[model samples]
Target: MIDLNKLRTFTVVADEGSITKAAARLYRTQPAISAQLKDVEEETELVLFERKNSKIYLTKEGTCLFEYARERIDEIDGVVACLRNNRQNLDGTIRLGVYFELTSSFVPEIVHAFKREHPRVRLDIIELDHDALEVGLLGNDIDLGLVTTLKKPSFFETQPFYSFQRHLVASREYLSTVSSTLTYENIFDLEVIASSNLLSDYKYWLKINQQNQLLKQVDNITKLITVKDAEALRSLIKKGAGIGFYDDFGGQSKSEDYAVVPVFPESKPITINIDVARRKTRTQNLLQDEFYDFLIEKSEAGLT
Candidate 1:
């Protein structure tokens, strides 16, 4: 059966003509948007798009589906609006800057639940890098920001979002080649995949844990494949594209086809912390304040 949510995503992608643009318009990540489009195509069992010159164009079947999707969307919009009007009247706009990796995390569900209560409220979710997300908060461009960083920022009024451990992850096929009990300089012999930020964070972990000698392993990564987002890194690892660093926030670490292990088993445990934040100087409005409290409540409830 076709999922209307995926179909709606198809219409947005069709209207925008670029997965990146569609992601931005819908406040989602490009990878998440691409995955949704793939699902839509699978459900319909037809290729709905073609790529050329780094852009997406509708196929003949896609064009037909787009027309039907638009009609369904038009009708759904009216029904949704009527339902919202009859729901709680709390109304205000809240702009959120979310870390790119967190786009595929549980944050969206939290936002959706908040929307269910304040149906009239407007939320603008922007996918941003950690640096840009922080800049958005400092500049007052976004009302709230979600980010993953090692040291918690002292300036922002913050609430706990998510905390996780990122470790070396690989396919069972790959791990079997190297000793699963890998340590220290053994990394020099293995092909590794990681983002630049992950490399830096790992280095910091090594230094603080007094394992300075192991720092060379991070630098000696001769066979390295770099990717931008956590999802891409995990996807590549699952396909035997070398080992990458990741947290099982999505709880797929025990994924049947793969193995997740400590990047450095001998080192002290290190954690990646994601936080929900607002500028200390930013004034609290009804919607923003309520959403902030809601996030705290979710954290306490372990809602993820």
Candidate 2:
């Protein structure tokens, strides 16, 4: 194997055409430079430099080795520079776990803006339900998460980044079939369109209403349709399939199709709070840490 230090010494001497000049350029003694060159020739069993007068010249073999050595060193230098530049630029992948519903929430816009700012930082977005999102984060399968519930608070650090009011809403077409005044009793009887795996959250919201005495019984949605994702839920809601609860942010609750008329007017609309979360014990990563900071910064700056 050729010693890079010796090969580098040889390349410099060839470039300067003098051991004295190469030594000054490299900040080494002339004798030290000459010794490295001698080791290079012994390794290759070829005299690389032919001293003409006081200047060094590359022999035919020396010229070939010089070209090879110069190319290798330059290539390595370029690679090192590229890697260092990437580190400085905070370029890497962030494995982001998000609740399926929040995928349609403000996350898209936030992610879009983040990507625009960090062109080199890629995101591996995994859509999971509230439970799976936390599981992924705790298991270290995901670098970070946007979770609605922090089930195991001791294991994670969370910051509430976004909050929105969730209202029990249905399309004008669906509401036309029901009484104008919606009671907890009447609303549950109507056809229900459920988003994936959010029954626990919905139950908690119901519990809030119960605490306020705004609702009494939670029994039946005689007809039910469970959608795969927020997009699918939107499609179902758009077609007026059944009544479903949705956030006002970019959801059907604000659309002309959904009748915003006081569904559960007695109780306050359920406020859904989303938290940006990560394991307290997770490994340190520059890209993930930068993005975690970016998320918090952007959220605090009213980007959410």
Candidate 3:
């Protein structure tokens, strides 16, 4: 039977590129680490590394085994973590990433409730956009991510948290310049300000109204000013730079900031779903599991 300890030592040595460095990292003597690596090579019947000019280098087999060993060790560590966290009293920090929209509106209430319940649990929240959230999840920089999306992300195991309506917003001053009724034709007469990332979302919403073709017309006839992000777009709209969009749930509390007018009564508020997601590799983490449940309960109660 291959020893897990030996495999671990080999992996560390491969990562460090030398037994001396690996020994220091593992808090073991250099001789002990070297012996562990030798034992691993003997058991596996593979020459894992070659030494030249006082430096160690991984062979072809060593590179392949390194990947396998690292995965196995990570899996073992995850299992141990899950077991430890299953205790009656929850403790430990959870790094959470949230989009800007939810940061101000929904997160405060959720955090207050969660902290009240589990006072010992620590939460570190960072505001990030959709792309940054994905990167953070994959890099293990965040334990949980809250984001709004029209399409599902393949990399995460996500649970639906809440559904919010996307509202068309503009300053009352700007709207007064147009006809009393807000229509696609009249609205296009003024400039449109929105996040460039949401242009596709706008296109998708237009398709549902059979006004998908209006996309080209809006692009050609009106001046579309694309901003860097939602915050910037909201700022522009508030300053009466142009018309923009925001989630009704996220912005309703700040409705005084802008006027919400539907171009068409049948206009479906672009239903964007806010979802809580974690890496697919993450499993059985008690804190994450409990927090996820709490979010669901709160969402079901219409707290968000």
Q: What TM-score goes with each of the models?
A: 0.62, 0.64, 0.59
Off by over 4 Å in 1: 1-87, 150-154, 179-182, 208-210, 250-252, 255-269
Model 1, 1-304: lDDT tens per residue?
8888889999999998988899999999999999999998888899999999989899999999999889988999999998656546878788888877667667678878888888888888888877888888888898988777524487688878778766655676766777867766576578777666357766866677787888866766678788777678778887777766666664657564345555565556457787889878876576788778878888787865
Predicted model with the maximum TM-score:
2
Total clashing pairs for each candidate: 0, 0, 0
- Tens-digit lDDT track of model 2 for 1-304: 8888889999999999999999999999999998999999999999787887988899999999999889999999999999767766777788999988778767778779888777888888899977888889888899999888877989998887877887766667767878877666556677777774335445667777764342333433447778867767866765778777766764546555434444555766788888899999977787888788888998798764
Tell me how far the alpha carbon of residue 231 in candidate 3 is from the true structure, in angstroms, after superposition.
6.4
Clashes of 2: 0
Name the best candidate (by lDDT). 2
Pairs clashing in candidate 1? Answer: none
